[model samples]
Target: MRDPVATAMQVCPVEIATAVLGGSWKLTIVKHLLEEPLRRGQLKRRIPLAPDRTLTRQLRELEDDGIVHREVFDHVPPMVEYSLTELGHSLAPVVTVVDSWGATYRWTIDATK
Candidate 1:
């Protein structure tokens, strides 16, 4: 999605959720952050497919949507951590359902193969 928080009206609720979290790694990132805050590098390791630039952009979009909280610690090297905001945490049920669906889909595909 070009913009996570679409300003347009008449958008379906599901459309809004997809608009905000449709990126390849956005939901996965939220799923991880739901457990605990993670440093930038940790997220990189967890989502290796997301290039550094792509991850940064997705994180920025999540932050803009009030779905993620980013904290920057001043150090010799800046340390940034990402965690879920209240809005993001609210998606726990949605993530859970998606996770379950994905697991089932994976199993079905593997069985077919």
Candidate 2:
């Protein structure tokens, strides 16, 4: 868990949710993992905007929060994959709502322009 999630006294449900989910690429990562397990390189390609370091950090945080499962295969190159935990899968509805809201917001902005 991140410092804010672990160390701070957050009282609001929304605040606690944000603490766990509000990092730069966190939601996007979760959204992608909702579909299927992916390799590190696959996630990097999917979220090309996030730097490797940022993806790595958010993934670590999510793992700490018990939202994602990271599995390693004993192979010549040590393959790794990431998949959403039961908790992470629970975010599907939230992700769908947010995605819809963002598209509506963009449409609204374009209409005004």
Candidate 3:
């Protein structure tokens, strides 16, 4: 097998961000945002795969990359919603492909267990 650390270090910055967001909940978050905006609690309820800390980290990375937009609503409840930025909308096609591939390969992947 290749050296994971060396391979990681060789990746460009943009690629690194992609790899980071490629974690369990990140793509799921983006995929949901493709259809509609969701508040933080809603996202949490939708994706129970990862811990909040991990999901939060992924969102921060996406926001830093100009892919995800976070909107804070001032109110007694203080609502916060996360949506895709223009750059994020560009990822719709990529997410579509990923979704297709996941659906196609899910059975094969599960069988390996």
Candidate 4:
């Protein structure tokens, strides 16, 4: 079966990149996942500002994009964990640079003000 997301992304690398990582929260989630796998609740705690449903949607989108993997264990309460895929791991450097740029930009703006 053809992957619709991949197919759509083929049109333009930049567009697809933005489509996959455009949102404010998606990159943040990716940044955290770069550290270690986390449970949903833990992720939520890390991003306390995100609404529960919004986080859920972002996670679903990330999973769909093949950037993150979700593992579920059968148990009394059920255990679910999220981790970055190999493809996702490749983005660590990019995220780091973006983070650095954001920090610099914020500092520059604050200094100017």
Q: Give me the candidate number with maximum lDDT.
A: 2
The segments of candidate 4 whose C-alpha lies over 4 angstroms from its true place after superposition are 1-10
Each candidate's number of clashing pairs is: 0, 0, 0, 0
Instruction: Report residue 62 deviation for candidate 4 (angstroms).
Output: 0.5
Query: Lowest-lDDT window of 10 residues in candidate 2?
Result: 1-10
- Listed in order, each prediction's TM-score against the native is 0.90, 0.94, 0.78, 0.90
Over the stretch 16-72, how does candidate 3's per-residue lDDT look in tens digits?
545545666778889999989998788888888779898898788777667899999
Candidate 3 residue pairs that clash: none
Give one digit per residue, the lDDT tens place, for model 4 in 6-50: 765778888677778877599999999999999999999999999
Cα deviation in Å at residue 92, candidate 1? 0.9
lDDT per model vs. reference? 0.87, 0.91, 0.80, 0.90
Candidate 2: tens digits of C-alpha lDDT, residues 1-113: 56788644457778788888988999999999999999989999999999999999999999998899999999989999999999999999999999899999999999999
Error at 71, model 2, angstroms: 0.2
Model 3 earns a TM-score of 0.78
Clashing pairs in 4: none
Best of the two (1, 2) by lDDT:
2
